[model samples]
Target: MRTRPRGDAGQAFPIYIMMVAGLLFLALAFFAVGKASALRNDSQGAADAAALAAAQKARANFGLGFLNSLRANALDAFLIAPFAPPCAEAQRLANANEADTNSCTPTSGYLRDLITVAVEGRDPVDSPVLPGSEDKVAKAKATALIEFRCPNPKVIDADSNGYPEAFIFTCLSGDVVTIATADIERPGLWESVSRTLFDVRLVDQ
Candidate 1:
């Protein structure tokens, strides 16, 4: 039987190592992209849900009472509830060498802003210029921010040059919701107008 070339064995080891390294790199990239995408989706969904919740609450009562009520409820529901699980999950997934969950706390500032914007934009109404009109315009708005961390350090370059140069990825999005109601012509219209505005803002949030 013919013997294999003597030098081939030495060459084969480096090739194997290179192939394994390439595979690991690709895997890390895929994992990081997937994680970032998932987090982005989750954040956007949470924002939309929270906004809609605030808006719906405002719509029901059609006044400042509605917005105030929803704001109080949302303090517990949206801002705190959704984050608790992810905070724990982040800690569990963190590596010894990687930054701990403490780094994630800074992101809470964005969450607070998001919740505030959503609640504040809950209702805004435009009443008819003429008396005895049924045409009224209402509007609502909401915003949210999302951050994603990669499990593998290799995928993200902390010092990379780009718009967002940091290893971490952050995304922000805003949405507007609107509804209209009948306009009435009468005295003390401003009270009704203010109430409608509050309700509209709540609905949009």
Candidate 2:
């Protein structure tokens, strides 16, 4: 109070600087978190899109009655390859690393090489609502696996479900329909980027 202002002025300056510095640090931390979140979302979206595209291709080829096994494998390979370049680019921007081959090994919970497609055929059967009338029905299931290395090596068995599943249906009127049922769960700070697509194709019998 008594002639203390002159001496305390310089001391106050340091306190002001410290406050400013703390604020700056907090701002930077928040910015970093936001940027990381955005990147994670982008990577996840890309993965889902790619998986769906590949599944559709597999369905189309199967409907045409093409080489089932080859088509399945080819479609998976084709779909996954395209994603590599884009995924790599995304990883770079996000400062993330690409998945290693060994990461997808059979022993690992992540998917490895082959894509699985399960086809189920249902013929027209008597509808419960329409006693005399018959209804057309068919169903197909397809699944694809994209393996990636986990950021935290300590984390094992990231996915308990094993693989994502897609369901497809076709009505007698040659109407194709598809539905996808895949749920993504994250543990700690890590999350799975899974893509699912439902596609249906009708053939002229």
lDDT of 1 by residue, 108-186 (tens): 3312322222111111122222232233212222332332111111113222332121121122222221212112223
In TM-score terms, candidate 2 sits at 0.36
lDDT of candidate 2 over 1-205, digit per residue (tens): 5565687888899999999999987886666556445544444433333333443343333222212212232333333332221222222322222211111111113223223322222233333333442443232332344332211112122245532243233433344333232211112111111212222222111
Q: Give each model a TM-score.
A: 0.34, 0.36
TM-score, cand. 1 vs. native: 0.34
RMSD of 1: 26.8
Candidate 2 clashing pairs, residues 3+ apart or interchain: 48-195
Q: Where in model 1 is the C-alpha error above 4 Å?
A: 63-205
| lDDT of the structure predicted as candidate 2 | 0.33
lDDT, residue 146, model 1: 32
Instruction: Give the Å shift of residue 104 in candidate 2.
Output: 9.1
- Counting clashing residue pairs in each candidate, in order, gives 12, 1
